[model samples]
Target: MGGALVVYESMFGNTRAVAEAVATGMARVAPGDAVDVIEVGTAPALAAVDADLLVIGAPTHAFGLSRPTTRSDAAARTGTGVLSTTIGVREWLEHAGAPAALPADGATPARRGLPAAVFDTRVLRRNLPGHAADAIARRLRQLGLSLVTEPATFTVDGYTGPLLPGELDRARAWGEYLATLLRALPLLPEDAGATGARGRTETPGTGRSAPRTGRPASGTGPSAPGSPR
Candidate 1:
């Protein structure tokens, strides 16, 4: 059986709930697969992440990925009930190191090219603009990991949210889809750069390197959450 590691950061626990649902969904489709879910603060060291797939999730803050400062703000918010430590996902990624690059000489290497996927929890609003999903995707791509799919966004009612109705189901479905897609991806070390493989045709750590302000695009303004990326 293959293994998956799901690491997530949550302030009001909305994102954490989505992470659990996503893991459950993956388990349903890949019954033989082992899934480990950990909060960012308690996450095992990145060097020890030997899972076949790495799935990450975070809540959108300040129209993009939450910085330490933003996380501090979240913790300070009234009624947040944030019992966990203050670490956020951005800090974790900075220390996670780039995913192993495709091995040279067509030989299998320890920690061969890793495949990753990302998702974000956002407030459900009609016109909310920026998102953490794109930021998260860029970071993974910058790390040289194969992205099985574009980043996925799940919605919440508000910042400290009960997820929107059926959003949990949608997240689960996305996870199952990810499991299926990963199962179909070419896994041989030599196949990393092949056409059918994801993200390898491009240079390492250069997937869709779009210039970003870490803010929403022009004419866009923050509204609610889960803005399309």
Candidate 2:
């Protein structure tokens, strides 16, 4: 009966579309479970997060996550079409404080470090390097959130793109996969580490390695294209 929250940063709305699709897929798989999607600008603080699972998405800028300067550049390119200009995922994570300590009364806490997944939208080009998803995964790990899956990438036709065909479908499928995985795993204690109290690996069922650093292990891609808007 756990819920999920999907938080995203978008320049031209492609990432927002993917975030919604992911939530849609999760809802379809677990209709009775709560699934919420939110823009990163308005996302709750880390200490305020109340979900059993967390999903983050953003656009790839330069070679990684967007900085204020990059976001400003994107805003200039779009005029008024940019979805978020003030704060991107990178800044949000940078300011994220650790979760509030558990209640001292031994009562169940509102939430604990969660199982998280990350995805990014990038140009659909072969052998292209850099993934915001990878960087996001690393930061979430540093915050002690266990990754349920490797970072994922969705491709746009270009820089401010309409996502390539099937990318939304792929995102939805990934969301469903994540929901399934969460449902299959046993819930752990609030203070458990990435490996869970039972010593099971972070990615149960899936054989993917939950490496702390390096490039994302799996993804879909496309070259820079038109904006979804």
Q: Which 10 consecutive positions of candidate 2 have the poorest summed lDDT?
A: 220-229
lDDT of 1 by residue, 140-210 (tens): 66655655555666767767788877777767776676576556555423222122222211113422211
Off by over 4 Å in 1: 97-112, 187-229
lDDT of all predictions: 0.64, 0.69
Which candidate tops TM-score? 2
Q: Give the per-residue lDDT of model 2 (tens digit) for 112-137.
A: 34678788888866545678887887
Question: What RMSD does model 1 have?
Answer: 10.0
